[model samples]
Target: MATETLTYGNGTSLQASNLPLNGSSAGKPVDIAMDARRVFEVLKNGGLAIVPADIGYGLVAIDPKALERAFVTKQRQPHKRHAMIGSYALHKELHVLPEREANMVELLTRDIDLPLGVIAPLKMNHPIVQKLGSETLARSSVDGTLAMLVNGGKFQDELVRLTSEAGLPLMGSSANLTGKGTKSLVEDIEPEILAVADIVLDYGKRKFSEPRPSSTMIDFRNVEVLRFGACYDVIQDVLVRFYGITLPEDPGRGANFSGHLREAAKR
Candidate 1:
């Protein structure tokens, strides 16, 4: 397979390999570190990039202008906030939650090996929280809380690690126009979203392409179901069987196309 240079709004061009990173029989081998580093550099320097995760592809940015561009490109609503690309370490340091709620997060991300979009109160004085300047903070947070993805996938984990080390918070949403549904494959991502990205990691199709488009987002404050997304069924079961908390049944995509219980949750 050949490598192609992908250029985007930030005027940065990256040589994206058409092959998968691991030496799978399907294609040639690419270096995950090298690719992640390049994407991190682009994002760190105020550029937008689309990267793959287990649940879906996402568009991430650190610059306020770039973040605004992403929102415009997606035509996302004003009320929707971008989720933070975060790790357990980052979550422990930045999110403020009760003991049981925090334990639930640990159980889901570490024990069950599930990905989650955790919405919780932010530790306002945390260094990483302070690092996200005012504009980024305003765009990424809703009220006093912020949503962060935990254990998304190998690629996202690496990216979060990089951002954490650099003291730069990465905030983004699923790489698709709002309401159009999350995209699981880089090739399936809309060209409009791709065009706004400075670099894109085309890591073939994501792992969880069925059941949902993105990670199941829960507001830890009250365990509200903001979005019934990927791995939702398993998450719902674990919460009930272990924590004895039952989440509302998914109405399926037919009734709730986006799977967002916004009205019921009042989010």
Candidate 2:
């Protein structure tokens, strides 16, 4: 099949290509760096992009208007918060977690190599947080905490590195319509969502496709299970064994396919 090229509202065109799943091939490293750079350039300038994650595909934007456009495109609820695309370094710099909580984040994201959405209090004075400005923050944050996804995948890791270095932040939710289960492959992403993206990075099928479409989200502040998503059982086991913290059992995807315990957990 011919490689597809897409043009976005930003006037830049992106060539979409198939990436080897999990970056398994020798060519994957260079392919990932190049694709990440392309998507990063789009996001940095307020353009939207559909990018793959281990948990699922995601819609990310940096500019407030772009963020609003994505929210509208997804028909997202007003109370739903966008998650920050993050790395271990940015999490340490941005989240003000206590030692124990911080250690848990390190173990899960770094040691265990899990894909997790970590909600924690943020450092208001952090440059990236400051750069987000008030309008974006209002939509992307909870009371005083921000949800950040760590170790989502290699492409996301590279993208976060660029955002971190530039002191910008990428924020968005699953690459699907509101209340719709997450899409693992770019092609499976809905037409509305695809139409809004300035570019789409087609990484083929992702690591953690449905019936679990997103990363397990936790409010480290209270060790609450906000969303029981991809790798829930694995994370639960690790927490129980290492920290003796027993998270509430995932009610199974059939009961909670959207992965939230409540509408409030949509963060």
Candidate 3:
């Protein structure tokens, strides 16, 4: 299928339809209703939407079939688990958060500037976790269990609306295939990856510091640094001071501690 490239403006302003009337390479977010509709129309039909996220480029898929297609497009491993893009409206359902963890996660990732992913706890028997497969979850889990990624931004509002409209769980994953750099610029995305999308929602290239192309991922349940990219030290500081959480043994080395959170467990 020919992937349509629609020029979309960057940032969190969700007000007013600025859909370009004439032919142009770019436009602001369409009206709230229209924006929600367009995204739903594509994803509910098993199509992929490659768009700029709070982090790097990501592909949003609401079903297993669409997810498979996204994995193939990214040339990712079949068993690799994808992260859920989260919103406040859907948080209670998306995560198995204790009141404390919920409040902490909310405070930590409340910006387009703070690029962090939270791996919150999930019930092993939960429908979404079961459908995602225990094996996949185990592989990606900090503790070899089921978890979710909280990629939050103002854009999450539209995602919340889309999920409500479609009534399907969503999977918002990095656009890159396994082993590829998480690309920040539209053109930096491999054409083969872009071609698989139903449409490319261009909000312009993201402006992030080097050595970290994507968000840093940590365990909300244990506060272990899973993967360090952007805002690594700052998040570590916040977690330590506010929550009495200890820093990861290998903070920026992307070490996996088998989900152990206690500093004494480090050896």
| Winner by lDDT | 1
In order, what is each prediction's RMSD in angstroms?
5.0, 5.3, 6.4
Q: Provide the clash count, candidate 3.
A: 2
Candidate 3 residue 195 C-alpha distance from true site, Å: 1.0
**Candidate that beats the other on TM-score, 2 or 3, i.e. the better one:** 2
lDDT of 1 at 257: 77
lDDT of residue 109 for candidate 3? 61
lDDT of candidate 2 over 1-267, digit per residue (tens)? 232333222223334444332223433423677678878878887788888889888989888888899999899878788889888888899999999999999999899899999999999888899989998888778878999999998889999999889888888888899987888766677888887887777666789865587999999999998888888899999999999999888777777677788753644
Candidates in order have lDDT scores of 0.82, 0.81, 0.61
Q: Over all chains combined, what TM-score does candidate 1 have?
A: 0.88
- Error at 80, model 3, angstroms: 1.7
Candidate scoring better on lDDT of 1 and 3: 1
Sort all candidates by TM-score, best to worst: 1, 2, 3
